[model samples]
Target chain A: MDIKEYKKYAENRSKRTSSLKNCVLAFIGGGIICVIGQVLFNLYSIFTIEEHAKLLTSASLIFLAGLFTGIGWFDVLAKIFGGGTLVPITGFANAIAAAAIDNKKEGFIAGVGAKMFIIAGSVIVYGVSFSILYGVAYYFYLLLI
Target chain B: MKNIIKFPEPVSIIQSASVVGKLEHEGPLGQYFDMYEDDIYFGKDSWEKAESEMCRRTLSTLLAKANMKYIDLDLVLAGDLLNQCIASSFGLLDCNAPFLGLYGACSTFAEGVIIGSNLCSTHQIDRCAALASSHFCSSERQFRFPIEYGGQRTPTSQNTVTGCGAFLLECTGYPPYITECVIGRIVDSGIKDQNNMGAAMAPATVDTLMRYFNDSGKSANDFDIISTGDLGKEGYEIACELLYKNRLDMWGKYTDCGMLMYDYKKQDVNSGASGCGCSAAIAASYFIDKLKNGCKDILLIGTGALLSPVSVLQKQNIPAVAHLIHISNSRN
Candidate 1:
């Protein structure tokens, strides 16, 4: 077979996924996670320093996501809920926790720590670089004004 | 024709066994496997070691079922989804027979049977054992990601099977013999996506099937069943279309070991089940059981993606191959 023809066949033979279903699941699941975070923030607001409420809510969501990942519930949710579980801070926590749990057999330092960032590594890299760029831009803006 | 090997002499598959880890036992073909593990690790500390243990169990179980000892085999053939075929080397360390460790990725078992059957038929060996195994944990860390890495898997991604299969072949057994094998050429589709292996591997599967049909002068409909290993759901569909385009027209009576090895899409196995264990375990356990139960003929095509982490990092395209063995319950 011609190389071009073969490439076309390779690319096109498989079935396409249902995007409509995925969008629906993501919308619903993501809404629920956001609601939980808001509830946590409200609950913490009444008890602790009002200034710490946002931090408390983030910490609570991360903790819960990590816990669910430890028990293998996060994967089930991720598979079914699609982007719902992954569009929040809870997903970030799940990534770190999942890597740690998966590599537990490989050992703490080399296996877990080394591979813990494979997926999340790109996110961290971009985050830091963008923050630095924004900081420099803000400083320049202040001087120019 | 040059790539096809014809076995004119008589040989037979004596017995076989399949051993799987925890998650696989919940799949559709769970009942067909000889045994399954409740523990993912198979009682080993490391995932690599556990994979080795899986190979060991299948080897022993096949021998026990055949009422034979390790010393009875003239040679032992095995492989795994690892860098060095270490699982087989470490797993069968105690066997006194000479070992030939092969690496055909997921198709290692078919490669084993092709070689083992030829040896027995040619009178070079009276009895030979062939086994292939893979573990999800060991394979994922080596080939793609750490199990703990929370990356979103594509719909095309397939879960590596945590299992192994063993086959004992001899000069003459109760039934079924491997008649011919069509060794595949390396077919590269220029696919660089490591996550979508099913698509990457489909072209090679088509190439081998075409070669087999042309060289053997047999139509695709001639076989009662045609099965490819570890192509999962998407790869299987693609290969079917490619077959039609190539003029073989193998549209029906086709199944994939990767799909059948599982209960079929119930597990969140992304695309489907994959790895060396997918074809090996399913062929040895499920297909053999079916043959014994009156399913007469089968074409077991072992397909594999020849890609390494280094190769993928170097931006090399994944080249794939498929080797086929024509098996039947009768000597006719």
Candidate 2:
């Protein structure tokens, strides 16, 4: 085939998948996760202080996400949910716990313990760095007000 | 000079061995493989080590079957998907013979056969060992994502087979022998999707196949089967459509090891099996054996997408190549 001929046809040959379905699924999945957190926050507030209840809400969600990652069900959710499942705190727990489960065969100290933070490491580093920047921005906003 | 070269003198496939993982063992052709390791680790600490051990076992098993030691062979040509081809290096490290490690990714097996054939026909070496291996976990962790990541895989995503194929080639042995080979040229269709490797490779496969046919002055009808390495279903369709456009019809005689790598309905493998082990395992264990007891000639083309994870990250289009080897069982 000629180079000129191929260049014309190449665009048609390549596949471009539709993103609408993934986006919709991700929206629903993210909403469900947030709703679960809200329910947990309300449930814990009756028994504990509001601040502790807020912390417990995130903890429970992370636990649930970790369980899903350990059992290999997180991928199923992530398959449909995509970024919706990936953007939340639960995704962070899934990342860390999944690494541990994946390396379980390699023994604890060398495998699970060492590899427990591969994906989550980057998220934590960026998350902390971004929070500091956000805090500075909020302080300036409060001063102006 | 064109890449197409004919070998008048037959290069013998004296012995072969295949070592496959459990997923492969569950496939239809599982019973035919030389060895099956239920454990992916094979008692090794890491997936890389397991891949190395898998290659080592294939080489050792082939030598034992042929009543020859590593010292008996003049050279060993090996390769794999690992960074720096370390898998092949460590896999065949204990062997006494001189080693030449190659990196053609999934096409390493075909490259081995081509180079091994050249060595044999030229009388540079009497006996040579050509081997390749790939582990799904090791390769995925190296190239794409961590298995624990549970990333969503598209339909175009191919599952790398955790297997190894080893062949002992000599100046003489069986009826089915290597007769011709076409070293493929890199044909970049400007395909950038790393997950759609088949699409990246299909153009190269078509280029090589067309060249082979043009050089031989015969269409696909001349060969019993025109088998490609790892095009799977998508790439397979693309290649066939391209062939049909060019007026060459395989007439359903075209097959791919990727498509044959697993039972599609029963297996969750997205786009069938790939990697150097994909074709090598199938050839060493199944097709080569079939050809040895067959009636006609066959053309085996091994395709590879020559892109590393770094290359993918850089957003470079994947360049691909497909090497061809002609095998004939006819002695007269």
Q: Model 1, residue B124: displacement in angstroms?
A: 3.1
Once superposed on the true structure, which residue ranges of model 2 sit more than 4 Å away at CA? A1-43, A67-73, A80-84, A99-133
Q: Can you write out model 2's per-residue Cα lDDT over B37-97, one digit (the tens) per residue? A: 9898898988888999999999999999999888898999999999998888988889978
Q: Write down the TM-score for model 1.
A: 0.91
Report the lDDT of model 1 for residue B94: 80
The segments of candidate 1 whose C-alpha lies over 4 angstroms from its true place after superposition are B148-152, B330-332
TM-score for each prediction? 0.91, 0.90
* CA lDDT, every model vs. true structure: 0.85, 0.86
> Given candidate 2, what's the lDDT at residue B323?
95
- The whole-model C-alpha lDDT of candidate 1 against the native structure comes to 0.85
- Native-referenced TM-scores of chain A, all candidate models: 0.92, 0.79
Clash pairs, candidate 2, are none
Q: Pick the candidate with the highest TM-score.
A: 1
